[model samples]
Target: MKTIAGFITACSIACSALAPQASHADTLTIALDYDPADLYGTLSTNNPMFAMLESLYLDDPRTGQVEPYLALSHEMASPTEVMVTLREGVTFSNGEPMDAEAVVHSVTVFSNPEIVPAYGIYAPMIDSAEVIDDTTVKIVLSEPNPIVDLLLAQIIVVPPDYWEEVGGTEGFGQAPVGTGPFVLTDWVKDDRIVMDTNPDYWGDLPENIDEVVWRTVPEASSRAAGLRTGEYDLAMNLPAIDVDAINAEDGLTVYEGDVARIFSLVLSSLDIHETPVQDRLVRQAINYAIDKQTIIDALYFGKARLLNGQVVLPGQPGYDPEMTDYPFDPEKARELLAEAGYPDGIDVEFKCASNRYAQGLETCEAIAAMLGDVGINASLTLLESGEFIGQYVRRELAPIGLIGLGVPNDPSFGIGVYRSDWRYSYYQNPEMDALIDASRSETDPEARAEIIRQASQLLFDDAVIAYLFGAQSFFGHSDDLEGFATNVAQRFFVHTLSLAE
Candidate 1:
C-alpha cells in the first residue's frame, strides 16, 4: 500500500497535461460542495478554512501518524504534562508574532467551556496551558492521555491581539487570521471566498500556487460541467455517479483517495420532540428497514464500505470485529415496531443535505421508500449544504438526521463522543463512559484497544444511531492541475497544488 504522500506524488506525475506549457494564470479557482460556516475555529470541517489555518501537528492520511508542522518538537515531561518548542519567527497574517502566548490562547479558546462548546468534548484531557518561555509552552492535563499530541493537532493557533481587537469569536468568524500558506483576502457568504499566498510563511517554500478562489457550486453535475468548460480548475466532492464520465472526458482527470468520513442517520437519543425514535426498538427497526448495502451498490458504485455501528472502521485500532451490523429485513423491522407499540406505524422526519455527500439526496429518498415499506411514514426534508451544517451544529435538526462524520486521525479522539457532554450526542451510558475514560489514559496499546472494543460493543448493542457506510471521495480537476490530494480528514491541502505544464 502506498503512503498518502506517495499516492499524491504518483498522481501528480501520471495526470495528463492539457497544454505544453504550465498554466501561467495567477489565479486558481476551485468549486466546493458547501459554504464554510465559521472560520474562527477548527470545529468546522470545511476545506477552505484549512487553507488559511495552521495546526501544531499534521496527520498522515494513509497512516495515522503525527508529523511535526508548526511545532519543531514536543517532549513529554510527565504522563500528564507536555512541553513543546515552537518554530521561531512565525507570524500570523495580522502581523502578530506566533509565540507561546498565541498557542496558549488558541488552545484555551478552543477548550473553553463557554465558547465553541463542542471542542470541549475533543480536548477534555487538557487541564491548563502556560507559557514557559518566548518560544515554548507547557500543557497540564487533568489525566494522562495517550493521544494528547494527536488531539492537539486539531486545535489551530490564532493571534490573541487581533482576536480581541475585532470582537472575539463573532468577528473572527467573519474575517479570520492565521499562520498558513494562504491568507483570506475576500469572503462573500454562500457564494465564494478568495485567498492569496503569504510571502512571509516560515515553512517550506516553492509553494507554486499564487491565488485560490473557492466558489460554491452545490450540484455535482454543475461542478463537473464547470471543470469541463474551464470555469473551474478543480471541483471537489463529485458525485460517484459521474466519476467514470468525468475521467473519460478529455483534458480532465480524477483523483481518488481514502477518507474516514461515514454517512449515517443520527438518531435523537432523547425525546427532543414528540417522535418515535426515542424508543430503542424503533431505532433498531429503522436501521433494519434500510438496506445499507443496496444503497452502496446502486448509488456509490462500490466506492464505500459498510460501517458496522462504530465510528472508526476496520483496519483501524480498537475496531470490534464481533459487533454486527443490523441485517436488512423489512419483516423484522415491522415486527420490532409493533413490539414497541407502533403497530399501525410511526411518523418521523428524515433530514439530509443535498450537496454534502455523494448522492446524499438520493440516498435519503431511498431510505424513505424503505421506511414506507415497513409502515413507517418518513418525511424527507432536504436542505442545502450550508443550511444543513448550521442546523446540525446547533442541534436543531429533526428527530432523525442523515449526517457524515468521522475520526480520520485517531480512534482515541473518536471515542470521545461517548462523553455525556458531547455536543452532538444525546445519549449517555455510565459503563461506556467508564470504558472510554479508562482507554484515554491506558499506556498499553493492546489494553487500550480492548477497552475501546468493549465501549464500541456497548454502543453497537444500544443502536442509538443508524450506522451506515464509509464513502470514498472522488476529486475531479483539470488535467493541468498538479499536487492536489485530500487527507483522511477531507481537508484540501491547497499549498501542495499548482498548475503545471
Candidate 2:
C-alpha cells in the first residue's frame, strides 16, 4: 500500500509540469477544480455561480451573522410570516428593477419543487410571497422557522421580467441576470467562465479588477503550478503538501481559514439496503476504528479541527462542548465486528469523490487502510465530481460514502440531511425526526437551541456517521491580491478584492 508521504511526493512531482501563460493585468484569473453545472443559485447551496448573483441577505465577515444585502431591512411580522423591505434603485445587470415584485418572483420560483430540484425539499417551508408595495414584500412560512433570516440568505435574487422573457431557469442560466457586482460575459463548457464588472451595480464597484475568469483545473498540483507561474491569480483547494513550497516563492502566499463545512463518512443504514453498516455495533465500530487527529495532522498539517458531532460545529447553534469524539480503538472495533457476526472480517465498498474536497482521495486511502486494521476490508471506489454528485443526490451510491455538508450560520441548515424524508438521507430514526421537526418552529432562542442539541446528541449516540473534521480551505494567491476575503460559509467577497498597484 502507498503511504501518505508517497502521495504528497507524487503530487509535488506532477506540479512541476505546468507551463506558464501570459498574465492579464486587469483580469483576476482563478483556478477552480470543476465546472459549474448551472448559474442558477437556487438549484444549489454552494457553487461558483454565486459570484454573478446576489442574495437578499449575506453573512457578515467580521461576525458570522446574517445581515441584509439587497434587502434593506427585514422583521418577523408574525410567528409564520416575515416582511422584507428592498433597497430602492437596485437593478439587475439586464436593466430590470430588483424591487419587491422581483423578490416575490424569486421566492416563488425557489419554492417550486419542479423548478429547483436540488433544494426542492426546503421549498415547503416557504408557503408563499406577496408584494405589499413597490419596496416591501411579505413571505409566509408553512411553520414558524427560527432561522428565517439565514434561510432567506440563500435565496439569490433575480429579475422576474427577464426570467419570463428568457423562458425560465434553463434559458436564464445560459445568460444569467443578477444584481451582483460581476456580469457573466462568456463561458466555455468545462474550460473557463469569464465575467466583467457590472457597471450598473447598485453596490460599490470592484477596485482595479476589470474582468474575472474561472478556469477548470482538476489537478491540485496544476492549480498550484498555475499560481506560481502567474498563469492564475488565485487557486482554490490547493493541497496542504504544496503550501510550504508555494509560500517559499517570492510573489505567492497561501491563506488558510476554517470553514463551516464538515466532512464525514455517511453510512447507508436504511432498511432498504442490506449491509453490515446497518447494525448499530458495526457503525460504532467503524467510528472507533480510525484516528481523526492523525489524519488531520498528516494530511491537513493540523489545519483542520476534529468534529464532535455530525453536523454542528463549535460557535454555531447547538454546539455541545461536553460531547466527546470517538477515540481510536481498533481492538474495540474488532470485538464489535466479531460480536456482530463478522468474526474473521467484513468487506465493504467505500465510495468517494476524487477531487471534491481538499486531499479527499488521499484521506479516503488513509481511512481505508485504517479500516483494514480492524479486519474491515474497504474497497475504494473513486468517482469524479459530476458522477459523484449525480449518484449522491439520487441516493444511488449506497452502503458507505464520504461526503461533506455545510452548516453555514445555523445548525438547522446542516441537520436537515439526517431527516428521513430528506432527499439525500441514508439513515432513519423516529426520535431524530421529532427533534429536528421541533426545532423548526421553535420561537425562543434558548428553547430552539436545546432542541437542536438534543437532535445532535441523538445523531452522535446513534453513530449515524463516522464524524470526521471541520474543513479548512487553503487558497494559493499572488501577494499583490489585496482585500481578498471569504466568509465562514466559504463565499468570496469578489467586490472587495483588488490588485496592488
Candidate 3:
C-alpha cells in the first residue's frame, strides 16, 4: 500500500445533492477499513450498520448501559427478570409493525450461538423469555445479570414478518431487514456501503447529514488522503503519521475514539486451563520486558492514550484508578525470569494477528525484542482474527497470542472471557469465579464495580495475561461532525453525529 501524504482539506464536494431536507445536499461519505458483513439477522460482522450508523437500540453509552430502542420502557420484573415494553406503533424501514413478538424472535436468535458466535456472550446466560402481551416482552436471566441491558443496545430487532418472508437465518443474512434509522441500499466488500435514510424512521434524524456511505479505505494513509481530498467525509483509523496535519487542516478535525481494542501476549500452557502461563512471576516479567507507553506513542503518533483493565475509558463507571499498570523495566523482567526458574532464559513461541488489531503485527515484533532481553526466546507467529479466536477459546492450540476482549463490550463481557472457565491462560481460580458471579448478580452499581475491580486484581495477581495495553479506538473525521463525542470506553456512536453543509 502507498504511504499517503498528509491531509489537505479540500472544499470541493458539490453538496447541493447531498441534502435531502436541507437547502444543500446532505449525503455524508464516511470511510471504514473494511466493509460491513451481511447485516443478516445475527451473523453480520460487528459492522457500524447494525451497531452504530444504521442501527439504534436501548443503549446509553454515557452510563455504560442499554435502554430500550424501539422498546418504549423496560421494567424490572424480579431480581433475575426484565420486562420490556416495545414502543407502540413503531414501524420497520420496510413498513412492518415492530412488535413484541419481533423483539422475542430477535432475542431468541441472539441467544443461540449457532446463529452468531459473538452474540453468544449475550445468549448463553438467558434462561427463557415470556411474551407477556402484544407490546411487552419479559426476559428471564439464569442469574441477576445487568449486561443483558447492554446486549440489547446492538441486537437489532427485526420484524417477525421480515424473517418469515426471508425464510430463516440463512436467508436473513442475504435479504437482511431491520427497524433501524437507515435501510441498506448496497454493499460491496472492501469498497463501500450505501444506506438511505429510513423514510418511516420513528425517531429523530441526524440533523446535519442524511444518507450515510461507509467506505473501506484499506491503508491508513489512503484513509487520511481520502479525508483530505474530500473523497470521504469521515474516516476511521486515520494514520497516526498525519495527526497534526489533520488537526491543522482548515475543514478537518482529528478527534480521539476509544480503541475499545486490547492487545495482549498470552502463554497458553499444555494443561489448556493450567499452564506455566498462569505464573504471576512469568506474566509480570513479560509486562516488565515490554514498554507499552513507547508503542502507544510511536504507533499512535501521540493520538492514542495508554489504557489499563477491560474498562480503560474514563467515562465508564467502573474504571478503577487503583488498577495501575506496570512500568517498563528490563532489569525487573530478568529478575522475574530468574525467580521463575529460568535465570538464563526460557523458549516460548509468541503469536499475533497480521491486521486484527491496529498495528498488531508490529506490536508482536516489538514484544519479541523485549522478551529476548529477558532470556525468553520468543518466536513471533501471526494469524488472522478467525484462527486466533477459535484456537484461543479452545486453548493450547493457538500460540500464546494477544487477544483483546473475548466477549463483546465491558465488565459483564469479562464474565465469559476473563473468568476462570474461559481458560485465558489455563487459569482457574474459585475466588475468581465467585467474584464474577457476584458482580453479575449485584444490582447496585458501586458494589458491582468493586467486585469487578477485585476480579481484575485477581487476574492481575495470577499474571494470567501479559497485560500490554488497553484499546483506544482511534479514528479521524471532520471536526464539524456534530453529535460526535468521545465516551470513556471509546465506542463511536454516529447517531450522535451531525455535519455542517
Candidate 4:
C-alpha cells in the first residue's frame, strides 16, 4: 500500500526520465464526464472538487487505510472524542492560515444539515468541533463512532476568513480557495474549469504543469477522439468497448484499476414510490433475474469483480466470504414474482445516468433486458450526470436506480444506506437499524466486525438491492502522461500528474 508520498518517491527513483521537467508541456487538458455544480467539496459527494481542494486525510488505495494529508496527526482521545493536529505553515491559496479554526469551521459547515442537506444520508455524528490551539482541534462526537477517523477524512478545509468574506458557501464556490497544489482560476458552467498551480503550496509543487483544464465532454466517443487528436491529454470514464482500440493506437494508453464502488440497482422500499419493489419477494426476484457476470463480461470486459448480496467488497472488513451471489435463475425469479402477487408481470421505472460511470448506461440497459426475461417490464430512464446525481442525493429517483455506491474501509460506511435515519434510504428495518447502531459504538474490533457481518447478512436476506459488480475504472491518456494514479474511491491525485518530456 503506497501513499502519495511513497508514489512520488518511487517515481523519482525508478522513473526519473518521466519526472517533471521544465521542458515538458505547461498545460494539461483533460476531459471529464460532467461539470461540477459547485466547487464547495462538502456540498456534494460525487464531484471533481478534489482536483483543487485538499482533505485532511486520504485513503490509501491498496490498504484502505487513512493517510494524513493536510493533517499532521489524528488521535482518538476517547471513544467519543477525537483530537486532530493540523500541519503548520500551510496556507490557503488566499493567504489565510489553514489552522484549527479553519478546520473547525469546515467541520461545522459540513455536518450542518441546513447547509448540506444531503449530509442527512450520513447523519451528523460530530457533536461539535472546538479549537484547542492554533494547530490542534478537539472534536466531540454525538456518540461513540468506530469509524470517526474515516468520516473526518471527508472534510475539505477552507479559508475561514475568505469563506465568511464571500458570504458563505454559494459565494465561496464561485471562486474557491484551497490549500491544494492547484487553485481555481476560471469556471465556465457546462463547459470547462481552469486551475493554475498554486506557487505558494505547502507541499511539493507541480513541477512541469502550470495549469489544468477540465473540459466537459460527456460522450465517450468524443473524449476518446479528443485524446487521439492530442486535444485532451487525458480522458476519464472511457467505455470498455474502446479500450482495445485506444491501446492499439500509437501514443495512447489505457490505465485500468479496481475501484471501491459497488454498482447496484437501489430498490425503493418506501411507500411513497408505490412500486412492486416495495415487496421483499419482488426485490429478491429482481436480484435473481439478472445475470451479473454476463453483464460484467459484456460491459466491463470481465474486468469487474462480481459482488455478493451486499455492498461490502472482499477485502474490506466484515465482508463475509461464505455469502454467495444470487444465481441467474430466471425460473426462480418468475416464481418469486408470482408469489409476490404479480402473477403475470410487473412494471418498474429504471433510472440511470448515461455517463456517470464507465459503460454505466449500457450496463443498465443490459440489466433491464435481463429483467424483462423474467416478466419484469422495466422502463429505462436515462439522465445526464448532474441531474441523475441531483435526484439521487435528494432521494427523488424512481423505484429502481442504477448507481455506484462508493465504499470506504469501514463496513459501516457501505451499510449506512440501510439505516432508517438516512434521508436517502428507501428501506427501513428496525432490526437492521439496531445492528448498525450496535456496530457504531462497539469499541472492540471483534464485536464491531461481528455486528457489521450480521447487518450485512440482514440486508442480503431482505434483498435490499440488486447487487451488480465492483466498478473497474479505465482512464485513457497519452502515453507521455506520468504520475497519474487513482485511489479505490476513484479519486485521482491530480497534483502528482506530470507530462514526460
Candidate 5:
C-alpha cells in the first residue's frame, strides 16, 4: 500500500486532464473520491448523482426535517395508502411535465424488482402506484409501512416518454434527464461528469455557480491538494488526518457534520464459507480483537461517534443505551479463538474498499495488525470501489469484509438487508426477521421503537458484525464558497451552494 502522499503523486498523471486547467469563475469543480456507478438513480446512490436529481421531499440539512419539494402535500388516506398532490407546472430537463402520470411511471420503474433490483431493499413495501388525477398520485403498499415517506424520498423522477424513447434503464444512464436544478451535459465515466444549470428548472438555482463539474480523484490527498491549488472549489470526503493541515492553510473551510453511516467489519455467517468465521465464538473474538476507540482517536481525531451496533446512532430513534460493544480485550479474543478450536491460529482473508470511506484502507490495515496480535492471521485485500461493490452485491465477499452501512431513516431499512429473503443478505435469524416485520407494521411510534431496539440488541448480542465507529461526514471547500450543506443521508445539495464575493 502506498502512503497518502505517494498515492496522490501516482494519480497525478490521470488527474492532469483537469487539474492543470483553470476553472471558470462561475463554474464549481467538486472532487469526489470515486466515479458514480450509474446516474439513473438506480444501482447508484453517490453524492454527485444526487446533485443531478431531486426527490419528492428533501431533508433540510439544518433541521433534519422532511420538507416537500415536488409534492405540494401528502396525506394518509388509509394505513396502506398515501395520497400525494404534485406541484403544478413543474417540468423535467427534457421539457416533459411532472404530473401524477409521470410520478406513477417513476414509481413503477422503481417498484419493478426485475427492472431495478436495488429498489427491492429500499422500497419493498410499495405494491402499486396509480394516478388519481393530473396532480394527484396514490400509493398502495403491501403492508402498513411506517417509513414510506423516507422510501419514496429515494425515488428521483425521470421523463416517462423520454426514458422509454431513449430505451430503458441502460439508456437513461447514458443520457439522463431529470427535474433537478442541474442538467447532465456530459459524463465520461472514471474521469469527470459535467452539468449545467437547467434553464427550465422549477427550483431556485445557485446565483453564482452556473456549471458544476465533478472530477473523480480517488486519493484523498490529491483532492485536498486540488482544493488547495485552486483547481477545485470543493471536495467531498476529505481524509481526517489532513483536516488540521487544511484548516491551518489560508482561505479554506471545513464543514463537519454527523452522517447516518457505520463503518463496521462483517464476518460471513453462512455455511458456504468453510472458515473460522462460521463459529460464533470466533466472530465474538473478532469483535473483541480490534480497538475502535484507538481508530476513532488516531484516524478520525475523535470526530466520529462510537456505535454499539450498526443499526442507529445515539440521537436516532430506536437507539438502545443498554446495548454495549465488545471491549478491546486481546486476551479474551485469544481465549475465544482457542475455545472455537483455533488454538494455534486461524487465517482469514479480509476484503475492504480503499475509496469507499474516509481512511477505510488505513483502518483495515490497522485491524489486520490488531488481529495478528490476538493470534489470528488476517490478510488484507484492498479493492477499488467498483470491484468491491460488485463482489458485495453478488454476495461473494471474503470471510471478513469492512464496509460502511447506513440506516438512513428507520432501523428496519438496515435490518431488511440482513434478512435471508433479501438478495444482499448472508445472515438470517428467524427472531430478527420477525422483529423487523413487526416493527414495520407497528402504527405506534413508541411500540415500533421498542421492537427495533430489541432487534438491535439481538444483532449486537449475536455478534453480527464488529461494530466500528459512526462516520462523521465532512466537506472541504475554499473560502469563496458559501451556503454549502450536506444532509444526514450524505446527499450534497449543489444548487444551494454559491460563490462568496
Candidate 6:
C-alpha cells in the first residue's frame, strides 16, 4: 500500500524552516523535459526545472496565507489594493538592488508589457503597477483580484539592469539573468542543460552538490532505459507501464504520487456538449466509457486515485467532501452514445502531450479505448511539453486534447485555473465566476467555506470537464535518502536531504 502514514507527519513541518541537512556527498543529475534558457521570457514555463538559477520576486510555495518569496511582507490596504515591502539587502544575480520600482518594471514586462513567459501573449492584466518607494510597491487592482501576489511569483522577475539591456520588450530574450538559487551555465536544446549553484544564493544551501545536469528523454522507453543504465539518478516523465520493472531494478526507486492537477474531457458548452463533432451525450458517455479504475490499476499500478468530484484533493482548506466520483460503467457509456445520436460508432481525435505528467499518454490511450466502447472513435495526437503548453496550459482549443495542471497547493490558486482569464474555450461560467468572486471576498471562514462549496457544486453539476483523479504522491530515493516532503509540491529545500551512509 506504499504506507502513507508519513504524509500525516509531513504536515507538521514548520513551513519556513529548512529540512534537517543531509550528506551532500555527490553531484546530482536531474532529467527534465528540455533545457531551460537564460532569458526569463525565452524559457519554457515549467522548463527551469532548475528553479535554483532563476528566481522570482515572490516564492509561491511557502506563503499561501499571505505572501512569501522576495517580498518581506504584504498588506491589503483595501480589498482591491495591496502594499508590498521588498526584503532589504536582496540583489539580483547581476548584483542590482531589489527595489520596488524595479519590481514594478519587471512585472511590467512579465505581464507581457515586455519580456513575458515564452510564447507569452495576451495584452497583460492589471490596471497598473505603481512604485511607491525604494523597497515598497503598491499594486492597484482593476477589480478585486485577491490572488495578485501569487500571480506575481509565477511571473518570474528579471533585474531592471539586465532587462533594459534586452532592449525593452522587443529583444528581451537575447540574454537572461535571474535571482534564483542556481545559475544557468549552458543550454544545448534537446541535448542537455547544465546549471551550477548560485554562490550568492539568498536562502540556505544544499549540503555539497555543486551542480545539476538535466537532460531530455522524449520517448518513455528511452527515459526508462536511461534510468536503468544509471544515465539519470532522478528523472521526470516516467510512464505508468514501466513502474514494476523500475521497482525490481537494483539501486533504483520509483517515487509515486497524485499530482494536484485534474484531467477532464471538456464538453464544449457552446452547444451544451451537443455541438457538431461533440455532444453532451458524448461527454456523458465518455464519463461512463472511461475505465478510470483500470488506468489507475493496470497502467498506474494503483499509484493513483479514481476521482469524480470537480475538486480532487480534500486536505486543502476549502474542499468539499460530499461530492462523489463518477462511477465506471461501460454499458452506461454505450447507452449514452446511442442517445447522443451515435449508436454504431463515431470517430474523433484527442490530443495529448507525449511526455509531461507521468502516464500522460497511457491515460489518453485508456480514454481512447473507453471511447471506442461508447461508439466514439478516437485517435491521439501527442506533442512535447513546450508544444503542449503552447496549446493546452494556455488553454488553446484546437481538437480535444489532454492537459496536466500543476494545481497549486493552495485552494484559491488551485481554483484560479478555472477563472475566466484561464478558462480557454471549453470554460465559461457567469454564475461560477460570481461564486468565485464571493469566495475570494468573504473573509469569514464559515462564509468562505459556503462560497467554496457552492463553487465546487457549480463545477460538479456543470461537469465542465470529466473529473479524473488525484495523484497518489510519492518520492523514491536510495535507502539512505531521507527528509524529502512526499506531498505534491515536491520542493528542493536541499538543506533537508541527507545520505544515511
- Judge candidate 6 at residue 361 and give its lDDT: 76
lDDT of 6 at 307: 53
lDDT of 5 by residue, 339-421 (tens): 98889989889999979777898999999999999988999888888888777767777689997865565666666777766
Tell me the lDDT of candidate 3.
0.63
Return the TM-score for candidate 2, rounded to 2 decimals.
0.90
Sequence-dependent TM-score of model 4: 0.90
lDDT per model vs. reference: 0.77, 0.80, 0.63, 0.78, 0.78, 0.58
* Backbone clashes under 3 angstroms, per model: 1, 0, 25, 0, 0, 21
Q: 57-99, model 2: which lDDT tens digit per residue? A: 8876545578899988888889888999989999887788999
Which residue pairs in candidate 2 collide? Answer: none
lDDT of 4: 0.78
- My TM-score estimates for the predictions, one after another, are 0.91, 0.90, 0.81, 0.90, 0.92, 0.79
Name the 10 consecutive residues with the lowest summed lDDT in model 6: 11-20
Cα lDDT of model 4 by residue, 128-240, tens digit? 89999999999888888777667767777888877776567765565667888877656677788777777788888755788788899988889988999999999998888
lDDT (Cα, tens digit) per residue for candidate 1, span 1-501: 333343223222311110022332477899988777766543455778777778888774434477777898889999888898899999986679999999999889877766753345657778889999989999888888777667677778889987776556755665677888877766676788877777777765324467788898888899989998999999988888889998999989888868577777877776565688888899899989999999999999988988777876777679877677899999999999999999999988888997788788999998899989999899988888767877776666668889887555667656676566666665667787788788878878889888888878777778768888888888899877877776666666676677764
| Model 5 CA lDDT for position 235 | 87
- Candidate 4 residue spans exceeding 4 A from truth: 1-25, 60-65, 117-123
- Candidate 4 or 6, higher TM-score? 4
Which residue runs of candidate 6 sit more than 4 Å off their true CA positions? 1-26, 34-44, 47-67, 110-127, 142-155, 167-175, 221-229, 240-259, 270-278, 393-398, 423-425, 473-501
Candidate 6 residue 434 Cα shift, in angstroms, is 2.3
Clashing pairs in 5: none
* Candidate number with the higher lDDT (1 or 4): 4
**Lowest lDDT 10-residue stretch of candidate 1:** 11-20
